[model samples]
Target chain A: MHELTVDLGDRSYPIYIGEHLLGESRWLQPHIPGKQVCIVTNETIAPLYLSRLKASLDGYQIHTVILPDGESFKTLEVVNRIFDGLLESRHNRTTTLIALGGGVVGDMTGFAAACYQRGVGFIQVPTTLLAMVDSSVGGKTGVNHPLGKNMIGAFYQPYCVLADMTLLGSLPPRELSAGIAEIIKYGLISDYPFFEWLEQNVDRLLVGDQEALAYAVERSCRNKAEVVAADEHEGGIRAILNFGHTFGHAIETAQGYGNWLHGEAVAAGMVMAADLSWRRGDISADELARVRDLLVRARLPVTAPDDMTPARFVELMGVDKKVLDGRLRLVLLEAMGNAVVTSDIDTDLLAETFAACR
Target chain B: MHELTVDLGDRSYPIYIGEHLLGESRWLQPHIPGKQVCIVTNETIAPLYLSRLKASLDGYQIHTVILPDGESFKTLEVVNRIFDGLLESRHNRTTTLIALGGGVVGDMTGFAAACYQRGVGFIQVPTTLLAMVDSSVGGKTGVNHPLGKNMIGAFYQPYCVLADMTLLGSLPPRELSAGIAEIIKYGLISDYPFFEWLEQNVDRLLVGDQEALAYAVERSCRNKAEVVAADEHEGGIRAILNFGHTFGHAIETAQGYGNWLHGEAVAAGMVMAADLSWRRGDISADELARVRDLLVRARLPVTAPDDMTPARFVELMGVDKKVLDGRLRLVLLEAMGNAVVTSDIDTDLLAETFAACR
Candidate 1:
């Protein structure tokens, strides 16, 4: 197992990446500060890994709530069921909540823990490739709204995140590819050397090469940890991490959550962002082609859906959280390995880029 | 206007108490970091004060969400409406939420702001005495679950809190007296001098003596500000601030919310606490009588309702947020002016206290 720490002072927590970690009491036991344990998982994952975790947490007063899987279920009302179970089981402020599933389960459970009794101790046991490299590491826990993705939520950090790579063995091909998009994001945002490594190992990553997967997950988390440490609340630099998210959220919301995988949408969003960046003269045509080539080879979408018009995309992106002072502050690429969040975009360029993507 | 600060490092905010604060853009405009502002109020306060505040906040992209009045409306579904309004209005992360009602409105709005896009800027414009002295000062914002009061919430601080004393002119007699219950709480927790002052000045406060009322409000806020600043998240000293809350919450939840004003339930809860403390030899019978006398004179209920059985109170209080591990922590008066949260209590003493209260 490899370990990394997100240095957030009093809220700092460790991220453990390894194979077969679900049953390892060493990683799961220490963080729980209380006797009552509530493990929230999805229906798909419950049959696969619930018993393994239950064995690890054997001596505690354990409880489990299996929710229906999908991003569409990420609502306050569904999250309320987790709260209801906690209350019914008589879980107190100190009861530890274990989020044992993919990104959807992790996000909903993290939010449930955050709101339950005004916050409680929680451990993130991410089972999917997307969740292990992204959602589980950061403390950004929340649910999505009908009008927007992740519209209502909290920045409540978890006690720790346990990323068991063996759990990813069960992820479908498209799901695994979606997680790789985020892994690719870490490189695009700041590390050219890592981006080059990913480009070289793309084939190995796709064919279930465990060593390649481990390296990519570790590097992505390192990048995530550094950025999260510098700005826990996204005051400045953390916004760079949303390079493709502004466009991607629009895709996810417009397409209806769960209709398109988050990674697939983000992959397409990154291509659109690259196109916009090139139009603004920030990146050369060669760089934009390199970004698009990567997404296409990874078997992810590289363009907007046929149903989306420039106007619809613009309207949806208009309400994203990145908007500041009534102007959209987008995380745009300055180069292949660098990005910046700026509202200074040429009106014609933005419109043309959307038209091109559509 | 009299102002005091809750010193929580960078998250610190000011509490402004005076007459007619809604018109003062000097205090409102600075904390608002964005052009968008959403005023969240209930049906009772919207018609009386919304237009007045809107006039002061001229030139901003303002929106309003007026909810049904009362504690019964404090649910996740109801709070979701506030989120829906913000999204429908296209308000982004920088949008500022100003809660312009009593404790229910303030708590729901603060929770909404705390969760809207993982938090946004929020200001509290308290229109009730209970809110001014208690809810608005501390950053404890949440909604109620059927099983418990404040079972779901976040400790998110607002940018600032505005307490308009003149708004109290419209408050009913029972509501004003209920607010006094929390005012009395400040004294019982750690201020015998303030307790003595309230005992002597209860009649003046009840009769709407502005000078006396101002003194009581300011004093209550000072006490609240100190406790909140010391603990922030209720790790230790802050729990003392919840002296009467356990029994009070049981009273509130048992009778169904809105039936007993929060402060009214707390008033009876305090008497029950005093009765328990006296039984344990922590206070003299005379001291207990003094506590009961003030509550009776304030026109607040000094005992639990006749219908609540000891078993029911125990069952309800068992699920409260304060329950740590399997033990229930009761905040008992150590003396006339000091209190402590202790899990150490005799079983018979607790049952007898419940019997006595019933």
Candidate 2:
């Protein structure tokens, strides 16, 4: 197993990556606060892996909440279901909540854990590549509101994240592509060397190359951990971690949350942000093209949908959590492996960039 | 105005107590993050004081969300209404939420502020004595669930709390009595002198004597502020603040939320806790009697309803937030001004205490 630390001082925790880390009871037992544990999973993953996960939590009072799969169920009402399950099982603040599915399960379960008795211990057992590489690491837990995505949430850190790469073999082809977008995002925002490495290893990753997948998950977690450590609350330096999120979140909100996967929207959003950077003379047009080429090679969308307009995009971006005061501060690229947040970009130029992407 | 600091370092805020403090624009304006402010009040309090509060926020883009009164409305659904109103008004992270009602308003607004963009600035404009003396100062914000009261909440502090004594003049007699129960609680759990003062000045406070009411509000806030500053998350020192809450919350939960005021249930619970303490040889019969006498004088209930049985009370207390692991750690009195949390108390003694209270 490979371990990466998110050094958030007292709030710091470790992320474990390996072929089958979920099979190791040692990794999860130390973090369990009590003998009672509840594993929150979804319909898709439960039938396949719930019993396997239960084996690791033997000798503990285990309960399960099986929710329907999809972003459509990520609501306050769904979060309440998790809470009801915990309360009915008589789970206390000391009880641990094990999120045993992909990003939706991890996000909703983390949110439920955050608000349950003001917060309890929760562990992430990511079953999808997207969750393993990104969402499972950071403490950014919340559900989407009708007006926007991730509008209601808390900056709650998990006790530990168990990202077993072995689970990636079961993910659908489309979902696997979605996960690669975020994996590529880390390299684009912070690590140039990793971007070059992914270019060479893309085919290996697609074929379930175990070593390549492990390396990708470890690097992604390390990059995320460093960013989270510097800005636990997304104050300043942490905003860089949201490179494509401004455009990405708007797309998610405009498209109706479940219509498009988060990673797909973010993949398209990154290409748009890169083009906007090129328009601002911050990056070469070649660099922008390279970003688009890489996303295309990974089978991810690199352009905005035809129906989405600049005006609609602006309206959706208005409600984003990143908007401060009234100005829309976006995390734009200066170059690949580098980013900056700016509000001084000309509105006409941004509109033109959006038009080009569409 | 008299000011007391909550002393949480950078996150610390001041609690301002005085007559007509709500109209003091200078004190409120500096804390509001931007030029826009949203005041959240209920229908009962809005008609009486909205104009004065609005006059204080003259330059800001002021908005009001007048919700229906009562604890039943303190649900996530109501919290979302405030979120919807803020979004419609183009309120961003800079927009401040001013809670302008009793405990229900303060809780819902504070919770809405906590979850809006992961959290925003909140100012408590507490009009009811119950809110002024307890809920407004501690930063314990949440909405009620069908299964429990305050089951969903966060310990997010306000930027400031405005306790305006003048507004209490229009409060109903029953509500005023309910508020005094909490005032008596500060004395029961931590302050003997405050208890003596209440015994001497109960009539004066009931009739709205400015000096006596101010003293009660200030002392109760002082006690709460100190406990909150010491243990913001109810780890250990803060649990003492819930001296009668375990039983009280159970009563609120079983009787249906809004059937009895929080303070009323707490009043009856304190008497029960005191009786239990005496039965366990933790306090003398005279001390228990003194506790009941003071509650009776305040026009608060000193006993549970005759229909409530020890078994039902046991079931209710089992689900309380204070329970750790599987043991119920209740805050029991050792004297008029001292309390301790323990799970080792005899179950038979507890049953007798509940029977005596009934």
Q: Identify the leading candidate in terms of DockQ.
A: 1
Encode model 1's per-residue lDDT on B157-242: one tens digit a residue. Answer: 99999887788888999999999999999999989999999989999999887778888999998988888888888889899988
Cα error, residue B128 of model 1, in Å, equals 1.9
Evaluate all candidate structures by whole-model CA lDDT and list the values in order: 0.89, 0.86
Q: Estimate the lDDT of model 1.
A: 0.89
Q: What ranges in model 2 sit over 4 Å off?
A: A249-260, A305-326, A347-358, B249-257, B308-326
Q: iRMSD per model? A: 0.5, 1.1
For each prediction in turn, the share of the native Cα contacts (below 8 Å between chains A and B) that it retains comes to 0.92, 0.50
Give the TM-score of each candidate. Answer: 0.93, 0.93
Best by lDDT: 1
Q: After superposing candidate 1, which stretches have Cα over 4 Å from the reference?
A: A249-259, A279-285, A305-326, A347-358, B253-256, B306-326, B348-358
Residue pairs that clash (backbone atoms under 3 angstroms), model 2: none
- Which portion of correct inter-chain contacts appears in model 2? 0.50
